[model samples]
Target chain A: MMVPATSAAPQSGAHDKVPLLELEHLQMLFPARAAAFGGKRGHVHAVDDVSLALAEGETLGLVGESGCGKTTLARCAVRLLAPTAGKVRFRGADITSLGPRAMRPYRKHMQIVFQDPQGSLNPRKRVRQIIGAALELSAGGSGDDRLRMLLDQVGLNPEHANRFPHEFSGGQRQRIGVARALAVDPQLIVLDEPVSALDVSIQAQVVNLLDDLQDEFGLSYIFVAHDLSVVRHVSDRIAVMYLGKVVELSPAEELYRRPVHPYTLGLLGSIPIPDPVVSRSRPRQLPRGELPSPIDPPAGCRFHTRCPGATDICREVEPPLTLYPGGHEAACHHPLNVSSSDIAGAVRSPAASRSSGSVVPVPPGG
Target chain B: MTLRDTGTGHVPVNESAVGVLDVPAEPYAAGAATYRLALRRLRHNHRAIVFGSLFVLVVVLCLLAPVYARYIAHTGPNVQHITEVLDINGKSVDVVSLTGVPVGPTWHSRFFLGADADGRDLAVRLLYGGRTSLAIGVMATAITIVLATVLGLVAGYYGKWTDGVISRVFDIVWAYPALLLAIALGVSLATGGISIGPVQINSGSILIPTLVIGIVYVPYVARPIRGEVLALREREFVESARALGFSNFRIMASEILPNLTSTLIVFVPLQLAHSIILEAALSFLGAGVQPPAASWGTLLASGAPLFNVAPYLTLAPATMLVITCLGINVFGDGLREALDPRATVRTGY
Candidate 1:
């Protein structure tokens, strides 16, 4: 099942607009299985090599299952965690190893809204102090005016300032969280599972609010979530991550229409269609087996163990992320196509019929 | 409460298949601050009111101990009443009563509580006893709270070497029985009158018992608070505060301290009760308030030998001690309810 492509624009068509945030080969490994009796400690490879760039005013949706390093990647993207290795550039300035005091100036330009709305806001703090705290730190404008404006911008009652977080419902609490992030006037906001904790009915309201806020403030967002439809709703370009590495990156519509990697193909097949007539007619071809342990991950392609099209080449050699024309790219030795029998029986193939060389070297894009 | 989508027929018919809408939402709002909420809870607790009143009464009576001794009794606690103040039956106490034997209750006289073997008015001495006992408890509790808080904050906020060292030191102090430890300190520093470098403390000084009581309870206070601060360090709010670029000091004050306020309040009265009861036990063992400055503990000890004759001498001060300690304990239990931030309103919907 494929949604028709809406736009012809390539992902990297314009190079002049420098991305507000860039993460290069970022690696975050939780150090060691602790030794109870002084044995050798082993590293848990939480986030292996990951590289990404996010332009100003663009929302890059990152989709993956739990424990796939999506949350860790969001933290690394916002410079919340110093990566084990790799460069984090904020508008051409390196912030990877900056001291906390040195990172202060950059903090205003980047912010994060946590997953759980009620858990994220301090349970003891009133809404006014929660939002006004940032204002006090930045020391901008009159306190009351700024607080009322923030509350109003997030569609919360100005009188809500006196309320504690537990007094509000999930959606309303999330608005308070958004207001807090907006208080500093940040250019980039990394929203970690922003709507996963909400009711299905309330999820859309928060999504709409986020979309409208993005338009109003010209904010760049790295929306991390496990829901594909929610990601598709707000993102322009989508990055499909598996085991910390981005497996596929393309324009949102293009990736949904024709995903090259087998993992992305399996992911796209799993999104349920609402129409009963069409949904019952199609077969849901989900990937088999549990996600492999990151501590002792299968060698070569991290997805090879669960992948339906795992050839001998896939088990021995890791595939580099190769780009096709129109800014579509995937890291897979065997790209899913019409002839690939393992995918869904009614899978739609890409328009280009030529089966070129399997491996293509990539040039890093700005 | 579960949320329902606002629009049923408002959206275009073509877009009805998908569950998507841009409806405005009204968030829940209440205007009560944390302290306001806690104060409200405190007001509704009847136990807090009753016990707290009892404790206040005890404190006021202790504060007026000197006035009761001066005007009512007309004799200082250390003054020898002899035959002047005591009126037994219809006659004043003669030399026989003053010669180291306990006396019975006197009628319509300054020795309303009767006289001890020293011929001192037990009534005046009882009043002075309340002052010394309460003073030792209050001062020592203050010292224990301050030391525990500072050490706990330092150890918890900065772990590894600091936590390890402080924890080991606490373990060592906790290994010994608290009373035995207090007895050791009293024998060394209190028994012979403390003289350390520039500071000099006489054998009869209340400072000796105060120091002993304060140092003994440090481990108990520090252990629980250390556990709390360690937990607070891992809370998501602290991480969010750091992400917002607030300094560690600001985070500790604004994020950490407010959450810890209830825990701190609950410890105060509990620790105070413990200090007061401990001071009494130590004084009974000759480790507290020396001669000339008699607490309930020391006076009770002096009257133990003459129990067969004038049980009132020991009974009066003993009753005051029991009442004060029991009142403090009940009052402390109610304070816990008052300080608990999440205490539910149980009287009505």
Candidate 2:
């Protein structure tokens, strides 16, 4: 399955093997309200048609703002929630409709670290019981020796284990959560905004702990986050989602270097640069139009209503994901060409484009 | 914000970013179970300790009533020493004063708390009455809460139709005024006793009042337990339990139930108070505890007419009842404060 690519990264080696996990056409629609008469029932399309894959030991970053269905999609991926329709394949085995009993053995391989650290663990439980529970469940029973080893591995003292979650700081709690997930000896872990709830100073600590653990355990991760800088710091490949659809999928460097989708360019423009000098000189251009309701989405591309380069053709028919240089794919009608005349062509100056960095040669082929 | 204008060199270049920082443990770390922590808190509370000790003392007296009666009093609770022959300070003189009833505390011969209208030692009878009242309260609470907890957990966890059916039943039970419903049930069931397929209960059986009181207070305990369970069902920890492949039973028992210790502990003393009062009410109406049993309610009923004569007869049980209920209530309030984990939660997290 190894497919040689023009990208400088070595992740192309993953192409030869079956992905650790793959989702095909996932859809999750929640019932909003029942119709009064014989009318059709209304639904909130939380997660519409979407597909993705995760290679072994690879981190795929799923980036989107809140209400864009990142959490729901993650839930569907791990079978925490059954998708309205889709195939969730784990190493080429379909597990989408597995019953709770059938899902038990698979749970040891797939674990989720939720967004809120305090809420993820039972406050009534002691830290030892919290982490010890996973150890016991996955391995029948575990001694304090293994427990202490796990605590130390996560940069925590064994003495802290007997304390309750309330006594711990936010970063320490997240470390305990990581210890819990690792106790199960999982293959893939879904990190749902793992640092979004932490203070900025502590967020880096947790993120680094997660990165180090992934290498030590050879674990695959679906790191979902709303922060682009954080995602770029971690992900091998980035998939930008909008209104329950993947608008662009590309290698991390290539996507930032040549963001083919107008939506991606607008998102990049929003990240604040620490150098006040550069920020003062940068032009201010926000994305236009309101997000439509998921219940009654606009025709054709869901992003067309807000896309800066959206044309009437984008409004007439939905465009399939089109291939671009360096294996990048963007679903759009009038895609940006490159850095020279790229990103809305009219508002952006080549000088400002140069300021954004990521200037690279046009990739040879898809 | 870390991403600067290309030349700042502050942020990592995509591939290499965010270095590891190990956070050390606090200087003093202690992990204790909520129960042990609550116990430590209770020990620190002077009011709870004093009142809790008083309440325990009363309960111990009630349990050892027979010991206080046979070995110490030298007279059975049913014995009649009507004229009350007594040797006061080595002088053979009856202790009955101007009232023509056996009276005055002899201290010796064990008429310590004095004698009631029945010519029985009032002290011994008070202990026996306290024992009966304690039994009825505790037994009724045990029956009511066990039923309520099971119903509440099932209804709250499996919401739609199961919740509907159980809640409707709880509603119907809740609609009635507690004492009135208790009286009605007590009279109907205890009038001629009850006989099922293989079991038969006599009208005098203590189960009559216990059953009536237990049935009456079901809604009080069940409604709160159900409400707590409903909230807990939405907690992320509960969902995590399910995610970890714990069965519904494990999730409810191990995850949700342990978190409800404060609620359940708070409920017990209140339920005990209610059960005692309800049993007293039923016994006063002659539909509870029957004739031979000397419950606080029965003794009070018999002594009310004697309010003009032997005042101690009426005053003794009424005063004991008030003290017992008050001690329980005050101690229960302190327990609520002591057991509250939220009060102990460290802030600035």
**The best candidate in terms of DockQ:** 1
Q: Model 2, range A5-49, lDDT digits (tens) per residue?
A: 122223432667788998887888988787788878788888877
Candidate 2 local distance difference test against the native = 0.76
Candidate 1 residues A68-166, lDDT tens each?
899998888777788998889999899999988999998888888989887778877888888878776554664798899877887787876887787
Estimate, for each residue in B35-68, the C-alpha lDDT of model 1 and write its tens digit.
Answer: 5655666667777767777778877887887888
- Encode model 2's per-residue lDDT on B1-349: one tens digit a residue: 2333234355432222313223343433333455676677677778877877887888898889888888899887788776766766777645454465656456775788676655778888888988899999999999898888888888988889999999999889888898888888899988878888788888889998998899788878888898999998987777777777888898888888877767888889988988998888788888888866788888888777766866777788888778778878888887887666454653211
* Cα misplacement distance, residue A71 of candidate 2 (Å): 0.8
Q: Pick the candidate with the highest TM-score.
A: 1
Error of 2 at A10 (Å): 7.2
CAPRI level of candidate 1: acceptable
lDDT of every predicted structure (CA atoms): 0.76, 0.76
Error of 2 at A180 (Å): 1.2
CA shift of A292, model 1, Å: 2.7
How much is the TM-score of the A chain of model 1? 0.88
